[model samples]
Target: MGAGGDAEEGVELEAVREDEPMTDLDMSRACVESCVRFREGTLKSSHVFASVSCPILHKLEEALFCFTANTTEDASILSSKNATPVVLPFLVRFVDFDNKVFLEFHQIMTDRKFRTGKQLCTEGKLEEGLKLMKEAVDINPTKAEFRGHRAYWLQENGQFDEAKKEALTVLIKLNPSYLMAYQVYYNSCLLTGDVRGMQDAILRMKSCPGRVTKSRCKIEENEQILMILKEFCVRLTDLEKTKNFYEILKICKEALKIAPYSNEILVKKGIALFGLKRFAESVEAFKEIPSYSTSFRLLDIMSKAEYLSLKFPPAMEYNRQAIDLLNEAAPERKNLIKFRESMAAISEEIKEVLIAMQNKDWKSMQERAANTKNLINSGSYKNERLKLQMMNFEAGAFVQQKKLDEAFVLVNEVLSAWDTNYEALSILVDINITVGKYHDALTDLERLKGMKKGVDDQMVDRRILEAKTKQQEMKHATEPPTRFLNLYTMLKLPVGATDSEIRSQYRNLSRTYHPDKTRHLSEAEQNDANNRLLKIQTAYGILSDPGRRNNYDKGLAALESRNKTDSKNGLVIRLEENRKKYPKVFGLASSSEEGIPSGSSATPTTAPSPESTVTSKKRVQQEDGVISPDKVKRFKAN
Candidate 1:
């Protein structure tokens, strides 16, 4: 009988009796028929096909879930224990047919929903797409492909936690051999910062019997790197405590061979190098740390390395970050609090000395510089670089106070120890300039150009030109022309002011000259205020752009050279007097080529008659040299 007819009668295969010797085809037909009855809710829980082997019944029990039995009672009924070898081949045949039917049914439904959902996602309807994708996953819960799409969209929707769960619980379980599920899991873990989960995914993928060879290789490489990190990263502290820096360095070298960009190992390497008294190499190692990996230990080690390298500002910042991390982690720890206070005091002293130098508070700068020097010498730091820095600052103070001999001595001493010391070189150059030793200033500038590590080639060239110009000025006793309205002068800033200083000065001047602040003044005063504000805006526009500012500086230098030439020739270049009266001819035109002085009328006083044109040409030719034929013809035509 057909399975549909049997299902209609609610018979649980009682018609197929055990005493009947059934063929393989008959037994296969019986199981599928019984499963169909269970799916339709017509099969009684106590009903069984007695002639079918137990293996056939077991296959039916497994297929019942895929077929979706009507109730849990129906599922439990299909769980049979009786077995016989006679129907085993028939049981395998039955399972293949059932799986084909199940796959064909689910594939059609799942593909339709998945394709439509992906189309919606491509069109940017993410919510609708996600809902349809969920429906597809629900239709085929065992299909890895369907669930992988859902997990990806969830990740795109920023539901990272949900995406991670879907990938780990469903996709990976369904298809552990494929790369797609593991890739989705690893990427989701990255966004959530679940680093350990990411490592787990990579490790699992390393053993996956994946079809993609490239992915498998990459996974194996990553697993090797993880192994190295786990081993070396943990031993860093113990090795450092034991002062076995050579061992630490050896571990770092081996680990770096496997994972060159690993930040943790790099930090440990820097610490080891620091402990080994390799300060320069330690600084190099510390510089490789990415911004995201600036942990407390990295910052603390970097602070010590930089301080020993004689970079005070960077050391201060690094120490401050370490202290801030400590404050956040455990503020009540007595040792940490004491350490924070001590480091903060040292930073404060350095900061005050810098501030004093910037303000040109000579006495205060000298005193603070001395205090910081004493602190460095007496405290744990016995760095010669710090001593050089102090000497450089003291030289700067002395130069500001016009104590040239002492300033020169101090700066020269700093240069003797560290010839490439930028601050000391700057002070020595300034001292040379003050003492009218232009030759020495030029020599210092050449030395600066030779040490090209941090030098801006353009800036060094400009400074060299400036030193030469100053030397020429001193030799000729000729002053630089100060009459022009330069941007620096308009903004009331020094010539070599930094970008931050320019921005700050612009804001202050803008507020000072804003029209709202000048509303109560006279109309003339208001007009002057408007002009000043416009000038301020124009100056800021040119100064804020690096390219434009560089060009403007070149223009200023050219103007200085021109002014010096004029002074040497005893020739005064004056502004035209008739700029407003004769705006086009005498003011804008080249008067020197036209042989027209400032006060002379450029346009003829009256339109010369044709008869007077000839006489005018003669009078012009006799008074001047040769008259242009075009001018005579134009006069005649007029």
Candidate 2:
């Protein structure tokens, strides 16, 4: 062989000698080194790990680690920049023949990758580290660290279920010896609203302060959850979803024990009492926060309470006050989402009531009564509601009080504003019949019948009877020849007649009347004849005297007016004229006429004070800028 060939064979023989000494530890180390190199390449791709040095620096680092690992100080300083690199020296320290070296090498390789993943995690590069950790878990199933990292990533993304499963798997696989995954599992439980899990986690946290303390809780998070639960309970209470009042009250009482200062609880109590028909107690409960919570609802309920008290003027007064207060309390004009609906409903009811009274509107009244059925059953407006619902009560009251126009005005509002209200129809019925509007009465009655459902048929029949009675009364006032009314009769009989002719005619008529005229005939006949003769004589006198005739004609023209309809306007006019024409005759010729009205009772005829006859619309002068009933009181002073 040549010299060059001999040199090459000598190197090949030395390499074979080196391979002959390779042990099982050396083979395991080779496997670990291969894995570590792959991890380093991944770390370099991940930005989690620093770049590998230039070839010169890399060879220098390897030599330094090999030479200094025996001294702990050099090794510790070397680990400051990169903790994972320390695993290399720990592995290198074991002899090549030692079987423990391979296990140590695997640990160091796993730990280095893990340490790099943690640094990346702190910098918010979670997905990259999570990918590596998942792969590591597959490779090393018993390592809880890999599973813990995956669970943490899921928790960050709000994937609590997956995170919880992973954490549980890590705990199970680690045999409960390693407690690292306990906190992450607890956090997942909390996010899922598992209180029992939270308690267990909290206890574990307390056991190891350092571990548990790292699991941070946002401030007041617990209280916030409690607050949400409280509101949910309150809404349920308001809905009355419980079986009944007692059940709802119990629910409220239980909630109150948890939050005693709850305003919602107090309002709920008031509502419960109202539902139970305890008006006085309900009012007391509602009054608890009149100013605290300004709303039309409180006023509406309060008004209902007062109306149920059965005292009339107070009921009206309270209702008026409630309407006014609601107006003021509303957030906007016409924004009465609830109360306006109520007013609109009640407006129709009032109209039906008045119509029932007028035309004897039975069906309308019954319908109105039905509309108020719930209110009555609950005892909302007991007496006032009952009174308004009576047969023709409101209409009769209006007529008696000489407030016909006001009554009509109110009924008109009910018809035009309220929606197809039977209550309004009933009211109009009673009013029309009472006011002698037979045609109006008839129309409303028919309309009421057409709309009738569950009607009181007896009430309808009664209305028809009352309507006939009203028709008769109106006929008596207008019928041409039923009885002799002074001028009305005299004019009907003859154009002209002198006083003597009238008196002579009267005497002859009296004898012809017989017992009927002078209690010598049937009572009906006597009433009929006496009425005829007296009217004839009065009419003759009115036509005979020129002044009386002229005055009578004027009153006859005014018969369609209010005063002329009830009283004899001609008679009042003559009385007025007589007093003016002959004051002395009317006053009895007083000698000292002091404080006497011209035709008044025989008192003095002079002024008590000149201001007494000031004749202004307002009699009292402005006294200290106050205007009141005191003004009338001043005038009525002795």
Q: Pick the candidate with the highest lDDT.
A: 1
Q: On residues 267-382, what C-alpha lDDT tens digit does candidate 2 reach at each position?
A: 67667655554556666666654342355466566655544432223334444555565555566323433333443344445455555645665455545545544444344223
| Candidate 1 C-alpha error for residue 597, in Å | 58
TM-scores for all candidates?
A: 0.37, 0.25
- lDDT string, candidate 1, 376-420, tens digits: 766654555665677767777877776665666676565554555
Where is model 2 more than 4 Å wrong at Cα?
Answer: 1-129, 175-180, 195-638
RMSD to truth, every model: 30.7, 27.0
**True-structure Cα RMSD, model 1:** 30.7
